[model samples]
Target: MTITRGRFGHYKLLKNTKRLSPHVPDIHVYSESVLTSLLNNLQPLFIRPLLGPELIRIIKSGETYNLVVNDNEPIVTDRKSIVPCLIKQLHPKKTYIIQVNPTISYTPCRTFYTLQRKREGANWKTVHKTVQDTECTPRYMNFLIHWKLNRFLLAVAGKLGDAFVGCHTMVLEIGYAEGAFFLYDTILHERNSKWSQYQSFIRSRTIRPFMPHTDLCTKSTLKAFLRNYGKAIIKPAVGQQGKGIVKITIMPSGDFEVQKRNNLSTYKTFDALFQSIHSLHLSREDYIIQYYIALGIVDGCPFDVRVITQFDEEYGWIATGKLVKVAAPGYFITNRAQKLLAVEEVLSVPDSHIEQVCINGSIALSAQLNNLSIIGFDIGVEEGGKVWVIEANHVPSIAMFHNFGNNEMHTKITQFIGKRRRSLSENRKEEG
Candidate 1:
């Protein structure tokens, strides 16, 4: 019998549908010597099984380090004693690799900073520099993946690290849930019942003027909002990529104006306009009705700035980059498909002024969000240059920056990650 994919029990369901930030941890390949050193450090270790959640903690006692697993008792042993057991009992007939989970809390020294020595011509010894960028970057440390144990063997590069000197000093959490350790957006989007909770968080940012949203549950709700704003947009309370959105403009002439992805329509009454909207068959109360701020236009196209922010263990909230996205002419939505421009070229106002608002606004919102790794905000400026936050995304695409060909912004962001890793390495040592 043939089984259909994504039908009934065949498909997987997630409690949290939110996307985890695409960050490749700086993990090093494991080896014999590195494993021995890690044991001496008494570092907490995790042994992650393939296709299962990783181990949570590692406890060290003198020469032995205990590997801790979730819902399971800890495995205790030292480097010399555990070595034979690992190679013989664990992986006697197979070969595999392991390393530290960089995002884990117990990494030694906790920094991504490191020293490197590369061979030079004949007798010049080797070249060395701090790893500031991924290009020609050096691994701070390396380890072996214990396949049999299903746990990663982390390389604990000690307090001073690798018997040499290097710089790349700093640590920042690009994005992660705060003290609660879960992303703010994941908690917000996982349930339809969370609407009030998420809205209240936004309100706490003092964003009432920027995002004027009200229930769009009943006909009276729609009519009241129409009468109040004259122009409003209907959107999914939870959505992405500019789908299922409609902007309605109630003209002074008593005609309703509506704009969609493909067509524009006008209706004489709110009932008639909402009837057209009802044809889409979207669930009520699943959407929101919000006043549409007249966006700042460039060359007759509505444009907005998208700002990306991340938390550093050292510096706290940092706006890594910001760029402008302009919708195609007459297109109300801004995605990568449309044209993109530098913020300076689009905003007649000083670029710093705009950036500061984005930076400060993002921080204000992030402060209340636990383990906020990164968030992007869509902000618009009125003709008079007044600021308004259009929307926020937990996982925002960075196509605008790539489309604009801004390497400087890319470099700065990567550097922040590198620094944050370095600082984490240092921070872990202090905690130990």
Candidate 2:
């Protein structure tokens, strides 16, 4: 994660373009002739396709060759078909070039981070450190897999200046990105987004609830929703760790109740409820009101299922992991301090069907999103085995998985991400 150019004495998320390190080579530019020249200059570069296994390489160390998607295929590339072939097939963004031998299975390089808790303050900090996997700790484009814990210090002591210069990954810190929350909510807008796309995917009896919306929490807006649903959730437009969420429950007689973490209030009028909310330092403009999902309960508290997904061009979307989260007593959110269960332990739906529902939700969500390939989804199940999506998160915390002792899911996640990254890297082509 990024550790520089911060704001507000904290590592705030800023909208910035990612640039390659000034010390690295300028090899991001891609084109047919440019790629060929790069191959000649770098020697032994290969062109690939979006689908199927094929390698376009120089033949017999000669400049002349046929460009095809598969190594065994004999289709010849005409002059006009070279670049157009690429443009028509591969994804514009997911594609990247790797210098390693394409024949050997190589995993995409990834960075890992942990939420370092603050000792004195009531805050969590995203710290950049080392991560270990089955194979290696990815340092940007290189692997620290075999390196010792003090490898950097050892390299510095040996005066190997280039040792640490080109080995680190450039990761955008995700935990603090409030702008992404607002963006996801905005994309849930009916006009431009795939809210309907999700509908198209899961137009089944199990799709049990209305689509969620994000709106300003004005008195009129709140009252209008209360009049219709009698219950709704209020939360900040951009928040994390489930903080500042209030559930409003109104009876037919207009008696209203507001509940939050460890606190509850009963108000005689809507204005009084709004005033009570304002007294807690929350403003209508800063928050959004949405339908309060009637989540299935575990023990005595409400809970939701967290499904983690990875995307691929061939397979669409795949669920890597899922967890049943039980909210702490008196709270409506299953944030960091919550308990978790296996999906089969609570969800009445068949395990396979529940997984398929999660997969469909992830695919629809990824269709609307641009940057994230790994997404965390919060889903709720009702009494009739119907599932409703609560939220989609780009920077989802894996703390719950770790806390629940579901380490196998974490391994599945690591493997899926590595494979997905490699797939995204291979399918580099111009947008058609």
Candidate 3:
């Protein structure tokens, strides 16, 4: 079984299907003439790379066109100049695709939902209809019905499933435009979904407020962010165990200080600073740049809280365990820690507040995606007692509890796991 990856591959899969072809917007390989033609025909269109997370949207406004890259502000350009502008901004060798941007009802914001679907025997089911992209709690099926897209989206899912071999699950991104719903994108693999963690959480109302400012790292973005915040952290887009993490700070003497694990390097120029980080991180692959939260200190070391939430068949989502990971001496990341303390022992805020936030946030997250029974949230607290969510782990390790020697919390987590397993067993028995 062969599975195709990348946006262009999926586009081709749908384009060849007579029934699904019309639903997909007209997409073409990037060229000056092709782009110019698209601009003339479509008022608003999108420019996406063949592979990667970069997106460029061009919208017509009055006599000029507005180019919006990712979440940044729009840059105005005339029709004649827009093509050149993109060429200068985008990589020279990488291929890009231009497509007609659908006229969705709502403008792009911090919120969007994923339509989770899974193949059951010979059929595919839309398990999660609305991942709560907006404030109103609309049933996913009902919303699709209102837009008259219930059948269309389902059909798209089935077709894509058949096209992607050995793929039994998918997350569809649906959009409404011109009184019809269209497939905006598809998460065909679990790894792709995991890479979308930052994006998925930022859309949640419960989690967005607590999320620190985060963006993909680049030399320009890194310099601008550091100039504004004076400190920032760079992390691999897909990484674990706190490895490959880098922190940059502007010292009192105005030099740029970079820290990885416990070692520190200082540079006098932004160029030199960027080089250190680029060689250490950026040149290899994508990394996330986030505003550094001055974490609350515990025993002269910064620490962050870890809250584990699990779903109970009878009770919904619950915060089963909470602990603080204090960074070892001379380190900022709490991944490798010297001490593990109870939340109450370290945080000034009431224990209830932390639990409530974790539970509520987890519930909001569960609504966004499917097949979520457990989640571990990394919570950060500043010196001023404010809480921020650093990251949400989909498959949170129970080893932390065992390592901390909190048998009570460890038992609670295992009990929830056991209950979920038993529930699945009974369901399968009934099916059998």
Per-model TM-score, in order, reads: 0.50, 0.49, 0.61
lDDT at residue 57 of model 2 (Cα atoms): 43
Residues 206-282, model 3: lDDT tens digits:
77788888765766668768889999999876677787889999999999998999999899998788766765566
lDDT of 1: 0.49
Query: What TM-score should be assigned to candidate 3?
Result: 0.61
The residue-by-residue lDDT of candidate 2 on 1-432, one tens digit each, is 432211110111111212211111132234666765554442334443321122344321233445433223434554445566567545676343312122212332322222222121223332332221223323332234223222322222122112212111111211111111000000111211222233323333433343464334545567777878889888764566677788899966668988887687789987787666654534222455677788888888888888887776676678878988888887777774367788877877876776776676665544433545777878878766667777666677776676667499888787777887776666654322
Q: lDDT for model 2, on a 0 to 1 scale?
A: 0.50
Per-residue lDDT of 83-177 in model 1, one digit per residue for the tens? 65455323333332232333334222211111111111111111111121122222232233112111110111111112112211111111221
Model 2: colliding residue pairs: 54-69, 54-70, 95-428, 140-169
Query: Candidate 3's error at 210, in angstroms?
Result: 0.7
lDDT measured at residue 263 in model 3 versus the true structure, 0 to 100: 91
Off by over 4 Å in 1: 1-202, 205-209, 213-217, 417-432
Q: Report the Cα RMSD per candidate.
A: 22.4, 25.4, 10.4
Q: Which candidate is the best by TM-score?
A: 3
Q: Which stretches of candidate 2 lie over 4 Å from their true place?
A: 1-215, 251-254, 278-285, 423-432
